[model samples]
Target: MMIQMELSMLNRNGTLVSEEETEEVTGIHCENLVIAFAVSNSPDFRSIRIIKTIKMCSHCHTFAKLVSEKYKRQILIKDPNCLHKFKGGKCSCEDYW
Candidate 1:
């Protein structure tokens, strides 16, 4: 089954940050909450797809890549800017976005 989730904001240190704190907090960005949900609910789903209205931040992108590699699952994310296919600890965007 395919699952879609809303992103949550987190700081560089992995602490939850509020939306109002985003501007002043330079290192705050969205977190990959979908991965956690997928892990617990969809063991048979090897490939995952995510759609976001905004471009994914670097931290979330890296998290997705690492999860894909560690779990041996393929993750495809489509954002407003580009499509990121992550596998084997690498992303199709090559860290461009």
Candidate 2:
């Protein structure tokens, strides 16, 4: 994900809800993490949208669901549990957890 001011702010304030968004992380915490960035041509943004790919845990599946519904975004998460697609307030799990 793009390192926004939010990243530094969270590091300084220790208000980070999730360290999975940090840089140069090591150890088990660092495994299966992929962060990428892409820019949009929209005049309003003149900036890139950051994308993060960390292996989601079961709980983050819920988080992804909420985020997709709230923001109208597409999130395809790979986890030990399953591949999760959160789109249009719908999940691919079909009631399975």
Candidate 3:
């Protein structure tokens, strides 16, 4: 859910955006956004599902951090390379050395 939202938000409009743009994207308030495709408003589902099949992107990392802070929620993003958990003002990279 979080990861997918990150990916959709990243891969939206056929262009890859920058970190700054990601944060900026979050601030985007659109009437159309409310009617977006991600119809499920389940926060638990959001945390459980891995939105993108691929691993998290570098830019998405920063965006995830900002989201965790802004909403005061925990976001766990898993990639081919690592499993990352963001919460409590810290990131736990799950013993990935």
Candidate 4:
């Protein structure tokens, strides 16, 4: 559920740039959408599960681990490539992503 912040990049002077340029400069295309959902939903549940059709990007993957550790809860994220279990600042993939 990660959402891209910008569909296109803007320069410091506000000129638009290519998506490739944006990705190269930021190394990020998406932000963690699950964290917000998890925090709001956690009070009613002990664990959370997320399903994604695309591969989980590296940043969101890391954020999931942090959220899991901070909340002392488990997060299960299933992306097309793998299933990740995040807990206590660790991931089943061991940060290999």
Which candidate leads in lDDT? 1
**Rank order by lDDT, top first?**
1, 4, 3, 2
Writing each residue's lDDT as its tens digit, candidate 3 over 1-97 gives 2323433344546787753464456754221132132223545324432333445555556555555555555666555676677665456763332
Q: Candidate 1's C-alpha lDDT?
A: 0.74
Off by over 4 Å in 2: 1-56
Error of 4 at 75 (Å): 0.5
Q: Rank the candidates by TM-score, best first.
A: 1, 4, 3, 2
Per TM-score, the best of the predicted structures is: 1
Q: Is candidate 3 or candidate 4 better by lDDT?
A: 4
Range of the 10 consecutive residues with the lowest summed lDDT in candidate 1: 22-31
Model 2 lDDT at residue 89: 64
lDDT of 4 by residue, 50-89 (tens): 7665677777887888888888878888878888998888
User: What clash pairs does model 1 have?
Assistant: none
TM-scores for every predicted model: 0.70, 0.41, 0.45, 0.62
Worst 10 contiguous positions by lDDT, candidate 2: 30-39
* lDDT of each candidate versus the true structure: 0.74, 0.46, 0.48, 0.70
**What is candidate 1's lDDT per residue for 13-81, written digit by digit as tens?**
999865436533655443365676775678744687887766687778888989888888888889889
Candidate 2 per-residue lDDT over residues 42-84, each given as its tens digit: 2322322233354555444565566556556665555555666
Q: The CA-based lDDT of model 3 is what?
A: 0.48
